[model samples]
Target chain A: MASNLPVPVAESGDIDLVLRQVLQDVLGLSSERVAELDAESGLFGHLPELDSMAVAGLLTEIEDRLDILIEDDEVDGEMLETFGGLITFLSDKRSDA
Target chain B: MPMAALAGNWPNPPHADEYAVSFDSGRAVRLLIVPALFDEANKLRHFTVEVMRALDRAGIDAMLPDLPGTNESCEELAGQSLPSWHAAMEAAARHFRATHLLTMRGGAICAPTGLPCLRYAPVSGVKLLRTLLRAQVVSDREAGRDTSREQLLENGREDGLALAGYSLSPEMVRQLEDAELAAQDLPDIAQSELGGPGLWLRAEPDHDAAQTVALARIVAERLA
Candidate 1:
C-alpha cells in the first residue's frame, strides 16, 4: 500500500517566491516594490514596515505556507537581515523537512 | 445599517452586551459574520465591513457581531474562554435570526452549530495561539528580554498571559491550545479566489475592494 500524501518539493525559485509573498503580504508592500528587492536588499531595521512585531507575523505566515516549523531559537537578526537571507533560511528549512 | 449589542444569556448570569454591526434591508436571507479572532480580527475588519456592505447592496442582510471580551463588549477579556465565545455566538445567531454563518479565520473554531457555515481561511486555534505567543516573544526580544515560547505556554496555562495586547484567562489559553476547526462539510473561500493574499495576514488593517466583491459575490450566489 502506498501513502497518498503529496511529496514536498524543495526548490530555490519557489522559496524565493514564498519569501517575496511573505514580505508583501505581511508588510503590505506592493507587488512591484517586492519584485524590485534583490538578494542584497536589506530587511530588518531597513524597511520601516518590517518592525519587530511584523517579524512574528512574517515568520508564522512563512511556516504556515511553506509547511515548515521554525523554532524560537532559530529566529535572529541574521536570518531576517536581507531579502536573500530569508530565502536561504526557508530553502534550508524546506530541504531539512 | 444599525449598530447594537447582542444580549447573551448563558452560563447562568447573563454576559455583557457585545457590539454588533448589521446591514438590514429586511431581506429574507440573513448571514451572521463571525469575525477572525484577536489580531486577525483587526486586520480583517475593514474587509469584513466591505463584505457586509456588498451583501446589503446585493439584497441580502448580514451581521458582524463582537465575541464576548472583544471589541466593545463590556465583558473582560481575561474572563472569557472559548466555550463562553461559543455560547455567545449561538446566542448571536439566535438573536439575529441568522439563516447562515460566514466564519473567518479563528472564528471557525467557535462557530455555532446547526447552520450552513461558509468558512474563509479557517484556521486552528493552536496555530492562532502559537502566532500570538511568537509575537510576544518577538516583542520581548526587542525589549532585551529573553523569553521562550515554552515559557509563555507554561505561564499561560498557570496564571494566564498577555499577548499582542490582549489578556487571556488560563482556561481560555488552555482551551484555545486544543481547539480545532470544526465544520468540514462547509465551503471555503480560498485566497486565490479573492485575487490576492489574505488581508488578515497584513501588518495593519486594510481593505481590498476586489476581494470584497469577490467574497460577497460568492456568498450571494451560494445563499441565493
Candidate 2:
C-alpha cells in the first residue's frame, strides 16, 4: 500500500537499508557485510552468494518482509541487476500499491 | 541430543502404517510432526529429528511420517495433492492416537485442522510458489524462451513440472497457490517461538544445533 510509500531517492537509501537487513538475515550475512553493500553493488551475476537457488529463497524472503507479490513476467535482469535496481523496483511496487 | 529412535511403521490403520511411523504406541504419543516439503525438508530434517528426540526425552512422544511419494516411499508425486497430505497426517494422528501436532514451514498449511498444533516459521504457500514461478520465468528467459504467468500455469497443468528440484503435479501447484498459513486456517493453533534465523533462507544450507535444542526444549515445555 502507498500508505507507507517512501519518497524516491537518487541512490539506495530507505529501501536498500531495509532490504539489506533482510539480505543479512535471509542470506545469513553479517551486518557488516550487508552494510558495506550499496546501491551500485552488483548482484546475481556478480555475487557468487546469490545463485539461482539463493535467489529463490531471497525472493521469498523479500515477499515475506515487503508484502509484495512479484509476478512471473515481472522478473528480468534489469530488476535484479544491481542493489539499486531491486530497491527501485520495490519502491515502485509500494507506490503503486 | 537424543538418538533418532527408529524408522518403522506403527500399526492402527493398516494402510497408514504403509507410510508413517511413531516411536511409541497407544496413548504414550502426543504429537505428530509434519515437516516442510522439498529442499526445506532436507534442511529441516536434522532440526526436526533433534526436536523429536528432545520431545521424547521431555516425556512427550513425537512422530515423523514420510508423505506418500517422498523419502522412502515409492509412490508417484503426480497425484499427491494438499488434501491427500492432510488426510495422511490425519490418518497418522489417528493411528498414533496423537493429541497434538507440530509443523514446520509448508507443513503449517497441511496440518490436519481442529487439532491443537504448534506451527513454527509457517510460510504462505502462495508466496512460496511465486518465488518458484519467478525462478521458472527467469530460467526460461535466460534460455531465450520468454513466458507469461498464464502460459506457465497452462504448461504446468498439462504436464507435471519440477520446482526447486522436486517434481510437482499441476493440481498441487493450483492448490498450493490457494493455500495460506494464516490465522483463519488454525484459529486455536499456537505459534511456537523458535530462536535463530530461518535456515532455509541461507545460500548454503547450514544447520544450527543449538537453535534446534533450544526449540526442542521450548516445544517440550509448552506441551508439558
Please provide, for model 1 over B1-224, each residue's C-alpha lDDT reduced to its tens digit, 9 standing for 90 to 100. Answer: 53332333322238656778887556689899999999889888888988888888788788888888888777899998998988889988888889999998889999999999999888999989998998898778778889999999999999999997989999999999999876477578777887888987777777789999999998888788
Query: What TM-score goes with each of the models?
Result: 0.90, 0.81
Q: Write the per-residue lDDT of candidate 2 for residues B46-162, one digit (tens) a residue.
A: 777777776777777778888766876656777688887788878777766778888888888888877778787777777667667666666667678877656776777778678
Of the candidates shown, which would achieve the greatest lDDT relative to the real structure?
Answer: 1
Candidate 2, residue A28: lDDT: 80
* Model 1 residue B179 lDDT score: 95
The deviation in Å at residue B161 for candidate 2 is 2.9
- Per-residue lDDT of candidate 2, residues A1-97 (tens digit): 3455356574336567778976776568777888888779897778777766677777767876777777766678888888888888888876776
Clashing pairs in 2: none
